[model samples]
Target: MNRNDTPNGSPAAPQASFSLRQLSDADWARFGAGEIAYLRPVTVNGVHAIAIHGADGAPIGAAPNAELAVAAILQHEMAPVLLH
Candidate 1:
């Protein structure tokens, strides 16, 4: 018998699908108004690091890598975006 088949040869159970939430224009405006966190690259003491900044250009925090920086921002319930 196939692994996907049940005892009676029926197909396996259907899996649930999930989709991400789509932000509205107001939400994007909020994010642009310092309601979110942005990740930027910088040099600290001769070492490259990721710096977290608010939408108003204020320093929020820093991390050794982009992943950790994003995680830190998410932990604070804020959205993270990479700054060029």
Candidate 2:
């Protein structure tokens, strides 16, 4: 998700950061990198799992792998901005 901007076009608060509950090993593999970007938490089989939502707002899978990937992307991308 893109970050919110102020009226003057300066970066404002980041878009809401959402995360999945927790996911199964198999479901984690079903998700791809793109889907992981917008992952959210959801319940499955009475267990907590990471939920990957697409542009169409559909549940692609429970992507546990996304936790690290997303964080790495954010750290790499946002660190510069945050530091400055």
Best by lDDT: 1
Worst 10 residues of 1 by lDDT: 18-27
Per-residue error at 71 for model 1, in Å?
0.3
What's model 2's overall lDDT?
Answer: 0.48
The runs of at least 3 residues in candidate 2 whose Cα sits more than 4 Å from the true structure, single-residue gaps closed, are: 1-37, 65-84
Q: Give the distance in Å from residue 63's predicted Cα in candidate 1 to where it truly belongs.
A: 0.4
Per-prediction TM-score, please?
0.60, 0.32
Count of clashes in candidate 1 = 0
By summed lDDT, the worst window of 10 consecutive residues in model 2 runs over: 75-84
